[model samples]
Target: MLYDITHRTTYGYGSDVSVAHHLAHLHPRELPSQQISDFKLSVEPAPTVNTEHVDYYGNTTTFFTIGNPHDRLVATARSRVRITPPLLPNAARTLAWQQVRDRCASDVLTPDSEVGEFRFDSPNIARRPVLADYAAPSFPKDRPLLEAIVDFNGRIFRDFKFDSRATTVATPVDEVFKKRRGVCQDFAHLAIACLRSLGLPARYVSGYLETLPPPGKARLIGADASHAWFSVWCSGHGWIDADPTNNILPGDRHVTVAWGRDFSDVSPLRGVVVGGRGHSLGVSVDVARVAE
Candidate 1:
């Protein structure tokens, strides 16, 4: 499958005279299952300095610096990618969660593959026994790791509320677990913490999910939003995607941008400016699959 993605972000400030620095992880990489055929990015007013590099996790990161500021700033990223991701059956057999976990743990998982590990004490995903215990509903010990993960995903989706106003990026995993409310980010974080607590390695995924409209209704434009999910390392299957947000596996519809141990690693944009105050940000993204 191929896709044309266009993303726009704008920021408005109460005052203009300032400096801004930004890091962008919008570029996609060619992998065994997915390939990036063509890509490009543009920034308005032009940046004084811009640089691109691949991070430790192999994600393409672009840094931009704007000085002699203005009242508002806009950043737009556009790309046309030709992807030939494996079918769900093949992906299940090859990229299964069990397979990836073993490969990653043994240091054999390639950069092109979706395998990663994070420290248990990562800031946004702090570990807490109380929360884990609370989240422990019940599961059969004899179940496969992937099956267990699926079960957990379903439980979370069924029990928690998907409330955007319930939390922020700064919200701790423990708090979200206690409140039992949050968006996809919170769910991914909570799931990561739980998996790690059990000595498993899991990573955060930033991407877009092709949303479906109600039966007999046309899909709405701009209604699709950027999404977050989690991938757990399985001993035999590789890194498998599990969307705790909806308790479903991410298949062809999941368009990945970048991945890391936590949100900090794969944030679409992050940076520090020498001088900036009262700034605002707006982001828009469109992802659609193209027929061969």
Candidate 2:
């Protein structure tokens, strides 16, 4: 599937900002199942310095600094992407959850052994017994990794409520557990915590999810929203993406932007400004499957 994605973010400040610097993970990274083309980034109140570089996990990151004073700022990204459904080995054929965890835990580490790092705590997700206990029901003795993980995903969807106002990006995963509610980001963090508590490697994925209108209704221009999900690495089969908020495996409708230990590693746009106190922020995202 092919997609044209547009994301715009605007910040209005009560006071002018003397200077600001920002790092954006807006550029889509090339993956085995996705291709990107015709990508562009635009920043208003034009920056003095702008550059792009690959981050620790190989995701493309762009940096820019605005030296002049400004009361308002806008940043936008446009991209054309082609995504193919990721393939997975038969759920029943994959190794048991315990065996995969043992392999990931082995001390014979290699330079490419980044997966192990995710099995520990991160800036947002913390490993705790509560998380492991939540994941326990999904893993029966010798359960295949894929089967167990999918069931876990379903459990989260059924148990939690998706409420945009229930939590913020800074909300703790444990609190979210008690509330049983939050947006996609919170759910993604909770899912990551659940897996890590069990010594499984899981990464937070940030991107877009295409929205289709009802059969007889017209599509709203900017109805789409940024999406967050999680992926678990299987020893032989590779990574599998799942969305607990929507209770579906990411496929044609999902456009992956970046993956990291958690959201802080791959926030679409984040920065520090000298001033800009009492600011208001607004964001709009649109994702459409382009015609052949």
Candidate 3:
């Protein structure tokens, strides 16, 4: 599958800004399941300095310095990517999950992918007995690690709610688990935190999911925004994709842009500026699932 993605973000400030430095993770990388054919970023007001480098986790981070005096700033990123991922049978779930967890436990931990700050001690996700209990159980001693992960993922899907307004980025993982309501990002975070609590390495993923409408209904634009998921390291399998939001493994329809230990690391854009009391941010994204 191939896709054309256009993302535009605009910031309107209450006062003029003197200086601004921004970080962007909009570039796509070639993974086991996907490849980046072409990508680019453009900034309005012409940045005084712009540079990009690959982070330790293999994600591209772009830095830009804008000295232009303006009340509003806009940044746009556009890309075209080709993805070819193998489709594993649903029955393979349990085996795949176990494989990923075991592999990650053995290898694939770099300084970048390592869990830095321990949020588990804060009672966010660690306090949840259910998550802890699930992590404790030894499932299918003879089963592959991937399979175990899939089994755990299915349990999460059945137990949680897919509520969009239930939580924010700052919401505690324990609260999210108790409420069982959140978007894909929340679920992904929860899953990562839980895995990390169990001493396994996991990473956050940001990308677009190829969505389909109900029978006879037209597809909606912006109705489906870019999505968030997670990956666990497996030995021979490498990093395996898991969509806790849907209790399924990501395939070709899952277009990955960037990855990191947490959302802060892979945030689409974040920055600090010299002057701006109040600001309004507007984001517009278009992701289309096209023919091969």
Query: lDDT per residue, candidate 3, 1-292, as tens digits?
Result: 8888788889998899999999998887787667777788999989999999999778888999999887888998988888887645444443444444444444357432334333234333343456656655534445556766787778778878998789977787778877988988888888877777665666789988778889999977766576899876654445678998888898777889888767777888899988887999888777776676
**Which candidate would rank higher by TM-score, 1 or 3?**
1
- Model 3 error, position 142 (Å): 4.0
* Candidate lDDT (C-alpha), each: 0.74, 0.91, 0.75
Where model 3 places Cα greater than 4 Å from the true spot, the runs are 87-130, 136-140
What's the lDDT for residue 116 in model 2? 83
Rank candidates, TM-score, best first: 2, 1, 3
Please, what are the lDDT tens digits per residue for candidate 2 over residues 194-246?
99999989999999999989999987877899999999988787788899999
Give candidate 1's whole-model lDDT: 0.74
Considering every candidate listed, which one attains the maximal lDDT? 2
Top-scoring candidate (TM-score): 2
TM-score of 3: 0.84
- List the candidates' TM-scores in order: 0.85, 0.97, 0.84
